[model samples]
Target: MSRTKLHLLVPLAALGALVFASLSYAQATVGTFYQQETFTGIESEFVCQPSPIGVVTNTVTESGHFVITDQGVHIRGTAIQDYRIDFADGTYLLSVSPSHFERTATSSVEVFTEAQQDRGTLYSADGQVIGIVSVFTLTHITWRDSNGNGVPDPGEFTSEVSQFRVTCP
Candidate 1:
């Protein structure tokens, strides 16, 4: 090859290597969002009985969607809801407010490996336990030997799981 061509190829090769390195680094550091909360339409309005002449509170429920995204993990479609409670009484009780909520949802994802027996739990941004994703239907398994030594490196193994679906109750 000509010197001019060699010089040009060197820079191009370096650029390609740089790009690949950046992409790999980004993928490695990319973390998953355990829980996503989206607001849906309005919910039904309710009236409180006994009008808590001293302290009255009302509870309301609304529905929304929660999406979980992770690099190698598979998650299914799931929905969540936001609940609010208003107190009509003069007393301002923090406990009366609807600050805590819980829901159980089922999600199915194809496990990439039979070795992986358990599905990890998903957490909300606020560190709340949201749902559990199970790999009941394994579709494929991929193995990578990063060192090119024909042997799997410790902590260097990864797999891809797909066909994830979710159910919320």
Candidate 2:
């Protein structure tokens, strides 16, 4: 090859490599590590109580499995939670219950924000979307006193707020 042609080819090859590297960095995969979070919320019969007696505190602390493919990111797992009054009346209300959840989205940041964008959305350091986040309603809830008792009855309240999040480390 001629000297001028050789120089031009070398520059072109280097430019192509740089562009390829940038694109590769921008893309995501299933990931080597799992993104995890702990979900907790309060359920009560009374409107809002600073003290506890009839109020139930629920928590779900479990790791979820996630996969990011060409189509989108998908997450699936069973979250188990325990409830308790932790107050005078709720000592016996703590027990583990499981809820199965799974979601598929175009990006890691889109899953949690799709239905409740105002509540949960994750952003990158440079303002790019990096993950999904926030507290949300996991299921329909009922909180009526079945026996017509003024105080909250056992198992009388079971409404939960859950949060699912994912961010690349």
Candidate 3:
């Protein structure tokens, strides 16, 4: 090839490599609390994760009082859960539950990745859309309720999960 062409290609190749490396480095695994709720003096735990692979166990606990009224009951119980966050890539994983509960509860997994462009969309293995996670930005994580309990519907549980922000490590 001509020297001019070779020179042009050299920079382009380097740029491509840098872009790929950045994308890989930007990949992160983190956890966040989406919602939380309590009923009859019992409180539920909130958990989140960017991926399910190789996640460390974590737990959180909170103790508070609850009030019951004729119209509705107000419960203030403690929340405890475990979580791990990947600050280098903006990924997280978390396992949350109530410290008072004797039985173990099931948890869900969710991930959000940066979009290639503004019009980009994210899809799961089953072709269902989760959400769009971008670089340097917080993406909404989600979990599915394995149980068929009508109280905690499938897809996303907001009552027991509290929202959290992903910070850099």
Candidate 4:
């Protein structure tokens, strides 16, 4: 897949984790709760040729609050991540991102939204800045389960809005 597509998947994976966690409260406990977590690992897919093709150490810290009512669940959260790609030559590229997300799910409808900004810096083996980059994205989606099957069919799912921007020099 293309790098842009791959980048989108990273946030989706994080969203999946939050959704899975909400499953435990399927009973619809009526209250507001908070959650925080930190994840660190090597994400090889984030690396590319000409810059780095090896391991990329990634760290993400996320925090959020969810409200469960008789009708449905609503969640809002924020995440900050840092990525470091190391090459065999000892050079590295560092990327940092801050993002916000919201999700609402009920019997008949669901909504998911996110906004993110990322900054990247290419550093020489000696820690000097060689280049810089910036990117921003906003996305929103809605689904109406007309059949009540809890699945977003082709006609039921709608990508209401999406915007992406890049700034580099």
TM-score of each model, paired residue for residue:
0.16, 0.36, 0.23, 0.70
Clashes of 4: 0
Tens-place lDDT per residue, model 1, 20-87, is: 45455554322112232332232222212123222213232322222222222222221222222222
Q: For model 4, where is the 10-residue window of minimal lDDT?
A: 1-10
All candidates in order of lDDT, best leading: 4, 2, 3, 1
Q: Candidate 3 on 1-169: residue-level lDDT in tens?
A: 0001221233333333344444454542221212332222111221222442332333333333322222221222333433332222234322232322111122232222111111122344454544543222212333445564423455454333323333211
- For candidate 3, the per-residue lDDT at 13 reads 37
> Candidate 2: worst 10 consecutive residues by lDDT?
1-10
lDDT accuracy of residue 133 in candidate 4? 62
Error of 2 at 126 (Å): 57
Judging by lDDT against the true structure, name the best candidate: 4
Give per-residue lDDT, candidate 3, residue 134.
25
The global Cα lDDT (0 to 1) of model 3 is 0.29
Error of 3 at 114 (Å): 26
User: What lDDT score belongs to each candidate, Candidate 1 first?
Assistant: 0.28, 0.37, 0.29, 0.65
Better of 3 and 4 by lDDT: 4
Candidate number that wins on lDDT, 1 or 2: 2
- Candidate order by TM-score, decreasing, is 4, 2, 3, 1
Lowest summed-lDDT stretch of 10 residues in model 3? 111-120
lDDT of 1 at 167: 28
